[model samples]
Target: MSPSDVSEADAANELMRLAKTIAKHNKLYHAEDTPEIADAEYDALVRRNNELEEAFPHLVREDSPNKLVGAAVAASPLSKVAHEQRMMSLDNGFSDEDIAEWLARVRRFLNLPEGEPVAVTAEDKIDGLSCSLRYERGALVLAATRGDGQIGEDVTANVRMIADIPQALSGETPDVFEIRGEVYMAKSDFDGLNARLMEEGKAEAVAKNVAFDPAKIRQFANPRNAAAGSLRQKDAKITAKRPLKFWAHGWGVASSVPGETAFDVMATIADWGLPLSPLVKRFETLEQMLDHYRHIETERADLPYDIDGVVYKVDRLDWQQRLGFVAKAPRWALAHKFPAEQAQTTLESIDIQVGRTGKLTPVGRLKPVTVGGVVVSNVTLHNRDEIERLGVRPGDRVLVQRAGDVIPQVAENLTRDEEREPYIFPDHCPKCNSEAVAEEGEVDVRCTGGLICPAQRFQRLAHFASRPALDIDGLGEKSIAEFIEAGFLESPADIFRLHQHRDAILARDGWQDKSVDNLLAAVETKRAANAARMLFGLGIRHIGAVSARDLMKKVTRLEEIGVLAEAIEAERSGIEKLPGEEEKKYRQRIDAAVSEVIAIDGVGAAVGHSLADFFHEPHNREVWKDLLKEVKPPDYIVETRDSAVAGKTVVFTGKLETMSRDEAKAQAEALGAKASGSVSAKTDLLVAGPGAGSKMKKAAELGIEVIDEAAWADIVKAAG
Candidate 1:
């Protein structure tokens, strides 16, 4: 509905709806590193909400997104830190008219004459995670994320590992200096990381005697996500491996200013062994500020790091302090954001791609169009609902967007002619011709063909040989695809039967005698795969590594899965099959068994149902029967240990001097304890480190026993 035709009640309802939507996007962008909407689309929503509120001032909601800076910090292994000075967001101006009005407002507020100069510093606003670094006596002390304006995640250990972040500042410095900036991964570095992941994946595929699938490589959605996920790692050693760089943009909670103006202070910061953006410029008028924004926009694609906008902050520190902030944003600074990169292209067709989980995703094939610096020919339609929302057709001219990552998306349908009909979403599995069903509360339509679909074969085989599953050394995705094409392997059972094709594999083009020997040897070693790994390798829907481990802990033998399957099938057929109390007893026993399976951490009803379904399938039963004949998987077992922390949940926090957090958790697990990642009522112990914060506090509040590193070491010795 148009804004002009809306009633006051509708406007109020829209405001509340927009508030919730914006808040959800904030969390997705800030905490999850996954944003559903582009920046331009988000801005448009905010603009519309603001306009509605303005039309009816009394209808302005108290929970309006305009009064918010950032999303609240999500739960993490990292301890939390409260900021000494709140981090504020900048007000945004999108167009020339918006910039002009902003300047006029600033002039009016400051009561400056028309000809008087208002020095502003225009700098590229880095599109990355915001961080604050505190230095005490020239030594780096603390580092944190800008979460919810007030509280943030303490990532000092990870931050120290960044090469650009100095352990000690050079030259003269304040007793307590705080440097605020952005942590970003350069485009080249991001590309290198993805390439390395792909190569590693390919190597693993070849090791498993399978064909490598480039599509199986894992990649971050964007460089910003790569930086955030790397920096927030529980293991600092892992963070150190990533290529991350920092650029100082401003300061917070400082003892004293380094220089008189923002520009001067930033210069001083650069002089003191800190990196600053070279595109930073000082402007004397609004026209110069706009020109600088334009210049930055033109050079954005060429810049090594991503930048969505240019920031114009008042140069004089005195004026900034005088202007202060208005709610969630500063009045002394403005962010001139560039419109999202979009291009008009003809959407030629939509194709369905089935995933390992049997879910179908619609992909749009489009006429090649250049967006940002990349040529995009394919875009994701997301789902059937999204297709209906866009009213898109095969011949429609759609607006495709390139935000981050290499994947393009159809942002809007520019339908000028009514000659084309709306695209019909598929009702049947495109590969297997099975009925495609969208389960309750699910956006994806999945095929019920189970092991029959040809498209799912490669993925299922890859999963069987994945690191978390069987951990086959030489097998990889590429070799699996090759083997499948050669008709040498069909199912997990066929993996063990690979020895029969030894001579055939040796005759292949890329096959070497030594490599083939190694691959066969790896397959032989996995014949005695651990029960948990064996269960995970089966590729049952909803059975992740952790869930498989948990389920194995409850049931010892592979045959127990078959027994449980029989019980569930009997119960489903009705207890009338049994007579009198036998029926009641059987029903009780089956319920107890199912409950035990569901009791495992991360295993819910969906997972339990999927497990039962797999076991009941006739084809799956035959496959399992064949697999069991070739491999005698060891029964799940827990060694008896005399330790205080045995069978207990232990949470580790802060920095450990003797060992990394990963090592500490590994040690805890070795002692028969569960190494949990968060604090909870079930936690029997908290392993507090040097800079332990929220976890320690919560443990104390809950009266959960807290032990330092020394005590933990003593416990380890005693357990040994």
Candidate 2:
């Protein structure tokens, strides 16, 4: 629906979800250096948020995407540094019209005569980690990342190792200056890094008496990610080993001004032994600026480093200062970004693939087309709602962009209006004939068959053998599917019994004595398993590798998962249908009967509900019992660093204005506190915000200490 058509309540809820979603992506891209979505997808979400905010200006969220600059640097091992001048990100534009409008705005802001010439400097914006290098007495002293614009992680030792960054100035310079630049890895260097990492992984596997599996090796997805990961290392040695390079773009906190113009200062930086963009030049008019942008795009493929766009800024420093800043970007500068690469193709058919979680994802089979030199045959339709939104049917023409890591993304359905019939989405699982339903407020329809469905079973079994889970060397997705097709594998327990079918396996193609031996031996080695990995492998909802590990830190054995599930069920059962008892009393009767699982650090209501649902199912319980009988997973015992709230149960309620709910949970975990969903008698503290409702009242009645977001932030800062 359009922004104008959406209800205020719906818009508010969507904006809330969008804030959380965008925050997650920001953390993945900026902090983790492992992006989960393509740039186009991320931009689409931001654009949607902007539209909603525009339509409902009164309902703008405090944690809106507009207010965020970058991600926080709190989780890093390195110490933090505060930037003297905020390292701002440039606002982006995609078309020549946008550039013209920006120039018009600049002229109007300065009250300049129409048709007068304005000098604007254009430079390549390389995709890399933003770093600020501070020099005192013409000598490099500190290097920090551009985290959240204000505070950043200190990487002084790491930047000193980069050959491109000089330890000291070459000639005359400011006594105190900070040069802001991009720390990047060239395409060739990135390829070499990935190759080296894979070889080292192989060597380590061999040393551990395990078969080599190249698929298990972690690799940098792109040059940008490689550069970020290399520079943010805890060890300076690792950064020195990486082929990291830098180019100066701007300056900050200078003791004195170097030049009157941006171009002049950039040249001074280059003269002072820092790398500057070779193509940097001043443009006299909008046409010249746009031409330079097009020229850069034409030669982007030949550039040594990855650059997403060209940045243009007012040449005169006086004019820039006069224009001043917007919220997160300068009013005088704009980034002209290249559009995502696209190709026209026909949507031949749509196929639904069920994931381990039973999520039904629609994939569009396309006529073979080339996009940015890569041949694409498939496009991800995302979900059932996306299919309906696109109004696409079989044989419709569509535009596809090469965006995702594995497949192209469906950009638009060109023949939507010419559709003969609307394609009907399946209400039942295409793989198992089981009823599939989309949960309320959810876009993706999922099969409720759980473990009984063959599709879910195959997916779940494959997940159990994945690198982060069981880490079986020879077991892969295709091989697992083959075993299932042959009826040799019924569940995860069947994996351990594979040795019994040795002669049967040998009769099949691609089966050898050494290969089969390696596969079974790999399974045997994991008999003494890490309980955390085992729990993650079970494909339980809301329990990821990290959360599984967090939960295991409290539990002695994997069997407690079922016990916790039962305790949760019993608590809910007792509360069910208490006539004349309001929803408030159900929570008030919180004696010792409440499940401890829900109160465990990092394991809250969401995870407790998922565990309860899993254990309540007979098929899931049978699979769990059979799998445990085959493989003996020992207790998960590990140490967590102590903090102020280390054994205390804490509850967060109401609208978190500055941070997302997930981020709040992460902070609680980092502080070694238990983040619980419900406020019970055990809750030591209640972090409440506006609209706290029932939880806040309960906390008051229970006499728990209440604090707001700012207070919680102080607690986190104190812990740090």
Candidate 3:
């Protein structure tokens, strides 16, 4: 009633709202891969809350979200795990200038000479939930999510669902070792999922609102949200359905090991069956590190998953220890985030596309939005289920935002009219008018058009010409698509016949003499590709680069493999009798055998099944046979066993006073030994250099033999 009373009421209401806002933001930014507001907006809310809390100390609640790192784990059937070393969060830098300042601080703390080179390793700061995994005697013992940097919830069961993580180490097992990483959703999987949601009739208002979609209602907001939500699920089955992936980005604790450098540590982790981040790069100078950051930003859109920023850390463990911690985060590392890649756009139209796999994907044709310097007109709608859920129809007003700032997506419907009819998904293929069918146990409605459909054929041809496949560099996706549209290229086999169109292509607009020559050169270069790469270029369903490699290892050439796969399929009466063991075991054996020969650790059954199925398809086999006439896989033999190192587990830790860590690991691998980073009892030998940390102590405790740089040289010389 009085002025003072009113002020008190306003303060209380503001404090309550701040707490709620912070909680929601934490869930969005940390748990969910999506953040509704920009970082500045979230920071403003937090800053206001801090000022108010400082003014009203008594008003500070015990459960304030500001003091927390992330939300609680999901209700998945995962066993609780407690981290031996707490998984602490890193402080962030909003810009390149911010990163430079952080580096300046690091230099000041170390009293380093001006412009002195500081070895830095830059890696993708994956947008996902933080987690730690523990291994004992080579066996996975625990998996936990980073809670408050002090304690974490256990999710071992859910973690086991990820095929990238090894249940057992490769070589000598450690007494105790912990590897830390981020769990995330692959971009492809996320796209597929959103598409499925659109078809299910549970879409929301904003792309942020789409978090409420029924398919993901129980899941988190974005990939990061999905990851955290999946990890925290009380039921393992729930987490399994989310298709979470792990990328080892860092380490927390290891009882014992030898290796002096961060690179050595990562090499060891990779040997232990952890999928390390692909973006990790070593730099000799701060300038090079900055360059890498820029490169990462440029390549962000091309990456298969989301990265909020680039994480820079001292390459050597000794340097990291010398740097130590500043307040809460490590002084040895910094997170450099790129500018936000989100924008508001009007929904001009919505279109449906049929994929090479026949799955229908919904794409939003937006009113040309500019985000982070890129002009985006189309955003992925995910699936028909998502359309129904968002209640989005043609002509509805909408807001579009890019997930990870690369994949443009409809964030949500900004405004809609009840008079507009809901966008109905076509029951037939748009390209061929074939009957579209949704398979049992599948989320997408697929067209049975196969290679006959124009869209599928074009996509397949484009994929076959991709850089990693046949490597027809000049045959860009746009060029391939255009050629297909112009009736120049029709199928994967047609790419070989492109010589016939040289004059025609040269006559076309923008087709200069140099361009034509480049295209021809690219095609010629692909004629003698390695078997694995050729198989990948085929663009078979579920047959990815990894599977293609696996298929190659089974048979020396494409012809033999095609015949073998056909014979195996012909001998079968049904899917049950297709090959070898039960469908699952048969696929697992193929994976294990292929992985063993290629030395590609962690290749799983899913990849193997996809390869086998592809090879068994009559149409696919016929296409391959025709293509093989023009292109031949190189006749090179991959040695599966040459040295004891081939299967031996070797752990490297501490500083290598002699050879560089990378050189050491390479030498070990050459000798058939699996060179690892951390030290454990299973570690055949701990290569200790000066300044070895806890890993050295653990190796000593475990009675694992410890060797210096000289001793390692002697061992290598003796083996040779």
Candidate 4:
């Protein structure tokens, strides 16, 4: 053959090969929980194939992987349902600003009046595979997975097993309706499944060196992967084996709907027995909606199901119709996603560290990986149980992901090496050489070294100076590490002694006089920090920021916390001897005391116990004593006449007159009134400055008082 002929044949074969490879990878990723390639690698392959197809349009084949959704539909017993409206996937937004831009484009296209408030309903965007169900006359007619935007495979029988998705709707039902939702496995459920696998001895054993070990059955990489695999099973019984849950997010189509508002429609759906995301909030304006998003982000870790981000939709049906559909997604709705929680990185080493509570935590040091733009080098292995379950050993290839964008954790071990040695739980603490014992009903094996462990000291110091703890500027993790390395700082009290070595630090390599001065200045600023900040900075095992604040509120003085801790401990010991009435009273008192100690909005029992334990510990008290000699924290402020918002319910709308919307909300929160989203009779003031939109009109119609941003500022100033 000629050179040109050979080249043509080679290109054709290459195209075919790429298509097959891409399709196989997609199957593994989307249907099987077993990804053959990393996301970056997969993206590169798709991009390359797209470029090739674009360059040679005539060569494109209908069955090419570039044109397909993913793998073929799973061989399930469920009858397939053809969708009335195709389940299209929405484009993702990575940041708040990205969402704002999307909203702006929608507004611009719709020619919405400037300064008109756009009411949006925000709900948790469940991290799971998308599925749609159709019901006719209250009875479920069809169930299908969102294969591609245009086509989907039916899985009616398999979906019927999901108890949360109602077989029929209640009351006056629509003639035809379509429900859209995500199918997911709870983290706890996933963990439990893995645990059961381990107990049953179905888990793969660690390989000896030079021997090949197969991948473990217990590991599913992530919840999304696990859920997808379960849903695609040939047997309905197999799908049922996985703890799958369905949460209704919205509707695709509805005939003869009774409600004027989307919320009303959702209420009907919830009444009909569809599980809805509990985090849904209806806001009157964009500001309130954003605030709700922030609140959800703050509380995301505590949620039962996984959420990638928040989804916002126009609350009013009329407005939604007015906005209409764009390309694949609706113009009236936008998905405002949180930063990516999962990331892939090369595992460098796995080291053990001791916590303040003396618990040994395995920390995996990785090649710095960026998730949601934050660099993460270290992730928690959780416990010895997790180590054994994952069959992860040092130097093995692993995937790291944050639990909920807060706590870093290892998601999977990708390399299937049977010869890899099993990680044995240490009998003694790696930090202090003290005996490590697993507590009853607990997974953590703790060291008995208490506060003396250097590793624990370093961890505590770093935690103490964190933003939510002491918030001491210039006293970051790097500075703490450097100080620890130089043997200049150890205990919490050592922070105040930095002045003693200011010259030495300044004289050291990579250090200058100005930097040294700044460090000392930051240390001085923290000396007068609030009681809550100080308490949190101490690095008590269970005492988190909220608990520290709660403790501070009840005790008023740092020293008084010790006494309260002792009293609580004594009361707890004598709980069995008390009369019913006395026990009730004692319980109330204890509850009140505990509440007061950790009364911050997000604080809980775990944090309270840590705080109590810290205060009661002789070593911690001794550290506190030594620390007090060098630096005294600010006096506790029990009562103040200044109101955060003076009991007034305030609503902010449109572009602010002076500060940004976020700044205005922060100011409002700092002052005292509940900053609300919508206009109602309960609303005291509607801050309608420049660009005030539908919220201003609604506020006026409802007879709720309205004020400008300047007026809102004045109110806050007066309260102060």
Per-residue lDDT tens digits for candidate 1, residues 1-720, read: 577877644464466557756876787788767666667667778888878866765555435676677877865789999999998778788899988887776776666667889899999988889999999999999999998889899999999999888989999999999999999999899889877888889899989999988867767757888999999999999999999999999999888888889999999999889899999999898889888888888988899988889898989998776566655787789988887788899998898999776778898899988776445678778788889888888888999886543456778889845776668888889999988998653466887776678778888888799765898988888899899999988888899999999999999999999999999999999988888888878888656555677677777886676676565565544534467768645544544455454565434344555677787778889988888889888888855567888889999999887766656776786677878888999999999988999999999999999989999999988986
Residue 270 of model 4, lDDT score: 87
- For 208-282, candidate 2 gives per-residue lDDT tens digits of 989998878878766787788899999999999999999999998999879999989988899999999899999
Assess every candidate by TM-score.
0.56, 0.56, 0.44, 0.42
Q: Rank the candidates by lDDT, best first.
A: 2, 1, 4, 3
Lowest-sum lDDT 10-residue window in model 1: 597-606
| Least accurate 10 contiguous residues by lDDT in model 3 | 597-606
Give one digit per residue, the lDDT tens place, for model 3 in 556-615.
Answer: 666776665554444332333245457555443544443343332323333333445666
Candidate that beats the other on TM-score, 3 or 4, i.e. the better one: 3
Q: Sum up the clashes in candidate 3.
A: 60
TM-score (C-alpha, index-matched) for candidate 1: 0.56
What TM-score does candidate 4 get on C-alpha atoms?
0.42
- Which number leads on TM-score? 2
